[model samples]
Target chain A: MQTYSLKCYKCNVTQNDNSISRIFCEKGCNELLICEDISPMKQDPLQSMRDDEESFSLGEGSTPLIPLNKIGKRLGLEKLFAKLEFMSPTGSFKDRGSSLVINIARKERVAEFVEDSSGNAGASLSAYAGATDIKAHIFVPDSAGKGKLDQISIFGAKLHKIEGPRENSTIAAKDFSKKNNIPYLSHNLSPYFSEGMKSFAYEIYSEFGEVDHIIFPTGNGSLLLGTWRGFIDISENSNLSLPKLHAAQSSIIEPIVAEFSQKKWNFDPSSKTIASGISVSNPPRLIEIVDAIKNSNGSATSSSDNEALIWHEILAKEEGIYSEKTCAFSFATLEKLVKSGIIKKNEKIIIPITGSGLKETT
Target chain B: MQTYSLKCYKCNVTQNDNSISRIFCEKGCNELLICEDISPMKQDPLQSMRDDEESFSLGEGSTPLIPLNKIGKRLGLEKLFAKLEFMSPTGSFKDRGSSLVINIARKERVAEFVEDSSGNAGASLSAYAGATDIKAHIFVPDSAGKGKLDQISIFGAKLHKIEGPRENSTIAAKDFSKKNNIPYLSHNLSPYFSEGMKSFAYEIYSEFGEVDHIIFPTGNGSLLLGTWRGFIDISENSNLSLPKLHAAQSSIIEPIVAEFSQKKWNFDPSSKTIASGISVSNPPRLIEIVDAIKNSNGSATSSSDNEALIWHEILAKEEGIYSEKTCAFSFATLEKLVKSGIIKKNEKIIIPITGSGLKETT
Candidate 1:
């Protein structure tokens, strides 16, 4: 297997290509790093390899790009499309990352893995882990949806529920990884995992070819980052410029939006949002996220909890796509952009319905 | 356009091919009569036509034939595969029927449609109806899950909540259809709707070639009837006898099982079950269901509420398929069959999981 060297975001120092699964800048610093040189193998050869490999794919990628025909017409737009990521395996887009992460871990000879997620990520990781017959330990908030918890448990993963808040799960997962001497397959910190998400962008580009603007719900910025990379790859290799990217956040926890508008990187631990997926008070990839926004000529917008819920209802009723509040945040922001003329009515726009509404928080 | 005459099941009379969407033996008769003479176009050609026309599809058919490896090993069975139908469009097997039903309705120029369902069927119909831009009015039991109700409501369907038992919704839908002069597109009664379910049988046959036993949870018998037809077609074309079919029902609604054991043909209005989808007091295609069961050397079994719940958890924990209570009914029946020596250890078995766990009934 081909390998690459890890580079620290903080120190800008490249590390030796050790056989380690994950590496950080120093002993105690939070500056995580992963080998970024790896690219997708040639399509034809990869397809042939997969065909001959006795593939155990659980039908992970290629979600639907359902047309919002009536909604688009009603909004006075010529066309609108919502990529239904909720239709993915484990009922969330996280499955994209989980599939690749578990496969890589298997190749690395890792027997066990640990992850922390509010719900969707845990379920996704647990499912892929189950598929590969690897031991998986998931840490989740006690307040996570029972259905989501049931999903993770069904995958035979050992669940450790932290009682206090969302961040508690992360603390517990990290602690468990250390004590058990297992690799912490933290999705928030895994760049390799993020590579799997590039497929989402490829699917969109393959379908629409040239979207003028792309709006997405963001928390850890994985979708935005992966999409930006995908579009960049397409633009560089093909004959197209990347679409203007827009990240949607809940106003209650609009850290990225706050940072973008002020041109400052500050962590507000007090900020919170009912759109739990994006309720990141401190996103780990803040620098890359800011760079992505700047490079794509994108702006960050925030939606209120009420707005997200209302739009969730509208998207479901009008477009026949039932998505969670996190996914609805994108639509809420899109409406705002359209109202303010930030998004042109004639411009082709795409939004991603990130997770299924079946896992309702309420 | 091609049309077929409606033959009455009770009176053995044929009706003229009027401009009607559905037909019954008599004006007051509960059973629907479908013209078997309306030969469908060749399956391969139809599939090719769909492939040529559609721009985006998730490869909805060809679900996994997951071996109940651990459970089967425990039961001393060499093979037992569960057809994961929950991974269909709209996250349920109903998508198959809904797709066909909606296509036929669109072709027939039906402007308005109404149906009553506990959950999955309503959501499925609403989604396809929304896709085709047909007005959908769904009558659901008031006791339906909030999530399911929200799903139907999100699909922009007019939701009527029937206050009494599950069957009340069907009565309400029928009454609404009559009063409004709209077509009652019953998922249970429509032959065209059930045709989509033939894909399940085709998938199983393609995977295992020759299954000795096929088990499924009995609801409206759409899955059972469709698979039977598909297998019959395959058997006729090939040189093999049909597989033995096993219909699993909730003990609370043991109408089919009771009828099978006694070798009688009757309908009882009082048979009710917690498996809300199969709580139908009188399935319209009851005779056809009986015929399919008898012809395949099949047996009927009813699972208790406790058994269903237990198996539901087992499937989620062991198999990594978070199915609802109805799905458990199939596994519960399979266990019973194995214990009773009705199913041999060496025979290949196939079970179809009908819907997703997202539709949780409290």
Candidate 2:
């Protein structure tokens, strides 16, 4: 196996040891660590990261990339594609990350772990944990939809319905992990989990070769960061240039968009958006996400709940893609990008339809 | 395109016409028609059937087949596989047929079509219809889950919720089609729709090469007949023998099972099964379904509601496959097949996880 090192996202301080437990920099920078390769790049980047036996999969990744003709015509774009990330084993793209993180936990002989999610990630981790015969304690916001909660419990995970805001669930999971001396497998902070998302970019490259732009429905922006890393890895071997990676978020909870666009925005507890998956008040890897957008020369945008809901229905009616309201944010922002002349009408674009509408209770 | 003919399932009378309208036998035999290839079979059977431009798709078929290790161990089987058919665009295996059926309808220049389904097929047709911009009238049982109803309506299809028995929906759909002069695109009766399921068998052969047994949660048995036909087509080219194709049904509504097993069974209006997807009392192609089972050297079995529910939970917990209650019927019957010594412990087995559990309202 090739050796890897944990490099701080902000300071670039490298740690020789590549441990799953070491999520943050030891230099007190309080930034998430990224897996940096020490050995020469292999033909297959995933194989270089981990062996097939050490990896577990519920057949995540390799989702179908389809043309969005109706939606594309509606938006007056010549080329538009949607990666059906919702058709994954767990009905969400989070399976890509969960499979990798849980596989590592299993390899380390960890019998139990804790995680906190609004919905998709919890259900994803719970499913992966169940598949690997590991006990998982999924801390979810009590306000989380019944569909997701049921999905989590159905996979035999121990459900911890934490009361209060989404952040409270995160805090509860951390406290429980610390008290119980178990690892907190936060999908947001885990380097291994993020590394798994690199497959999305690879798959995009494999299918479309290279597109002009790629948009994401961002919350913690793990997928966005991983996609950037994947493109970077591909660039090392091929002359393919990086696709402009855009992050689409709900306007009511637009931390990344607010910072990137230099617009005044704040979290309002009283406010709510139908796109709950991206309703992150404060993302931990905010700097990393911004850095990726800056590096790709991409833009971050936000849309109203109504616009997202409208596009959600449009996607179903026009493109036959019944995706969650969160996924609609990309199309909602795509329209704005096109109107503003940032994305040319003829330019090729791809959007990852992050989760299925079936996961929505409403 | 190569010329095709429609052969009666019962009388075996061949009609050279392959029109989408000719669903029933022209000789007034009241039997369903099956598409028979007139041209020499090509390397790709699907290509031989329809041209790329003529076919519409929502990225259906080519689902991942994964090993069910924990369930295999519990069932005392050496090898067990599940084709994750639920991961299709519409969250059901029905997408395979809908794509072909709707594509044919589009080519026929049909303005509107009517279909009756318990849930999955209706949603599948609605999605494909939406993509093609064709008007679809989906008549569903009023007792159908809210999730499925919402799915149909979300795709901009007109939904007709019929009251009383499941048969009422079928009656209403046929009546509406006749009254409005719209074509009845009955998924169960459509030769093209059933023919589309051949891809399922082709995928299995491509992925695993061959397996001992393939089980299905049967309702109308379109997938079963299609798979059998596909295997036959493959056998013509390769030396691969047929896999015993079994049909698993709900004991409460077991027309295929009753006929195949030579047991006394009747549909009871008072009785109920949680496996609603396979709750068809009278399947249109009943004789054909039975013939395929017998020809494949396979048996049909039924399971009680409680048994199916238990296995459904087991599948989610053990294999991390969150499938609908209908899928549990296959596993329930598999246990019986193993206990009766019909299936050996070392033999390879496969079950198609037909639909996603996320579609369930309860």
Interface CA RMSD of each prediction in angstroms: 3.3, 1.1
Off by over 4 Å in 2: A1-3, A42-54, B1-3, B42-54
Which residue pairs in candidate 2 collide?
Answer: none
Error of 2 at B250 (Å): 1.6
lDDT for model 1: 0.75
Best by TM-score: 2
Model 1 chain A: ten consecutive residues of lowest lDDT:
A41-50
Candidates 1 onward: DockQ, in order: 0.37, 0.77
**lDDT at residue A33 of model 1 (Cα atoms):** 71
Model 1 alpha-carbon miss at residue B185, Å: 1.9
